[model samples]
Target: MPRRPISPQLLARQALALLIGYASARVALWLYLPLPWMLGPMFGCTVAALAGAPISGPNQLRMIVIPIIGVLLGSAITLPVLLSMPGWWPAFLVLAPFLLAALAGSYVVFRRLGGFDRSTAFFSAMPGGLNDAMLLGAAAGGDERRIALAHATRILVVVFLIPLFFSLVYGATGSAGGGNPARNVALSALSLSDWAILTAAAALGYWGGKKLDLPAYAVMGPMIVSGAAHVAGIVHVAPPTQLVNLAQLVIGVVIGCRFLGTTFREVSREMAVAGASAAVMIVIALAFAVPVAAIMQMPATQAFLAFSPGGLAEMSLLALSMGEDLAFVSVMHLTRIALVVAMARPIWRWVARRGEKDGA
Candidate 1:
């Protein structure tokens, strides 16, 4: 069956919804500077959506912006960043068990407390992006909507809570929040040649990534291409802050829109479960991050973000702002995503089938 072209009315609705989401995020920036735009709209849209508002999230816009995000991620991968990685070996050794522990622990929270079905709970508890969780879970017959909401709430909680903990508990004082908060490049500094190369990388990398069937290929593909460019010293700067923020705005809108028809009662009920699951993972991550930091003789702040189950790009950017090692954090995030994507589906399927057999 052929998929019908999107209707103009629906497109318009989506646009309006995104505008609302973007506005909400902008307002949120007053409270939290680091991820104000993304987090704010995400919360607002979830509320508006659950209330049965006519607005929608920015899914269509995300397809375009994700590539730009990939390009930004790529620009962070300089040759010097690569050389600064030998000290990270200890943490990498611990990442495997950390992934499994987080997954297993969260799965129990969803299944037992949230009352999710086997497949939905399994995928819901995964620490991957909302898009990845939904696609993977739906492929294995999980409730797509439930999985989407679960993952969305997970990200919202994790991103917000991690920073708050740092600020309130640790008394960390940084001008810009997260990773190595670098100076921003004015949009005016970008030359035509710069535009040409970046656009080409995004375009080509997205196409190639899709062809290769890679996870988050649009972002990862360009990351590879752009990372190569910067590593080779062909480019020295990331995408402009203006553009990167735009990417975040659209992505947040899309995430918020995923809850368009869910009721507030339902979202609230599940959110409690999601929040608990995320909290559990945070506790576990913190426990491991300390030892890993001590063993590696690195800062605790850097190790925490590296182990944190936030989005790869979000965590990387946070690391950048917090004045941490961007390359090391990026590498850790990439490793976590790859490991989750590779293992999540197969493990869930095995568990689902086993449960079915036991019931029969």
Candidate 2:
């Protein structure tokens, strides 16, 4: 299918948004804030949208950047990381229970406190797979707008809070590509052959992932291919720091732009509900993360990130910034999204049936 032609007006809006995002990033960097490239733009654009600016993120452009991030993540993988995969089973083992607990807790908050109906509350409280929740919630006769807003608010809050928590509490600070000197290669240092291989990995992996109907395939597919190449010793360096930072900037802009076309007053109550539910989920994540970290012999912060209810990409970016185990964090989030997408509908149906039986 051919692509739709973007109107000139839309282009102008995107440009304005990007400009604001860039300026915000500069201010954040000057203030020595963590993950400035991402958080700065996210906060800036969000405020702009709330203030009624004619701004919109360039989502199409962000898609083009996502593959680069996938490749960058793949570069973090190696023989040792691959070998350590088996040891991660304990973390995986607890994931289902943690998810269930998170769902139940958030459901109570949304349904009872927020006064949302069963379908809307259930879907709104889902911890991951925002797009899936919106689709399934709408199909289940829920308010799609409310579901979307809830998930978006949760994501916005989680993404905004996690990095700040790490930075202030743990004193963590670094660029999104991480602090490993070896991985921070300059763009000019790459050979033409390296560029060719990376490009192919991004293009082919994205196509293959989409063909297989994988969730978040745009990033996951490229990460898989890039990871394989790195493990096989086919690639020796990560994508340049410049490229990674650019990807972060674009992602932040997209996140902030989610609030476009809506004002704070309009969504204030829903945002409060979603924000409270998000807090509930985060506390649950922390409870799981502490024990998992002890068992995994990793930092609690890393484990917390792995279990956080933020978007996969956002958490992965945080992992990169914190110099944590990117592979582990990415895999954990990917698993959560996959499980949610696969099981959410069936579970919702079962719950609905139980509710009906109880009422009868």
TM of each candidate vs. truth: 0.90, 0.96
Q: What residue runs in model 2 are displaced by over 4 Å at the alpha carbon?
A: 175-182
Cα displacement (angstroms), candidate 2, residue 95, comes to 0.7
- The digit string of per-residue lDDT tens for model 2 on 99-120 reads 9999999999999889999999
Off by over 4 Å in 1: 1-5, 129-132, 173-181, 349-360
Note the Cα lDDT for every prediction shown. 0.79, 0.88
Over the full model, what C-alpha lDDT does candidate 1 score relative to the true structure? 0.79
> Model 1 Cα displacement at 353 (Å)?
6.1
Candidate 1 Cα RMSD after full superposition onto the native fold (Å): 2.6
lDDT string for model 1 (1-360, tens) is 987998888887887777787678767765555566566666777777877888866566788888887888788788777787776788989998998899999999999999898889988989775677888788878898888778777777887777678778776533332123454666887888888888888999999999997777878889889989889877777777777777767776766777777787767888899889999899889988999999988889889999998887667666666667766887788888888988886887788788989992
lDDT, candidate 2, residue 300? Answer: 92
lDDT of 1 at 351: 88
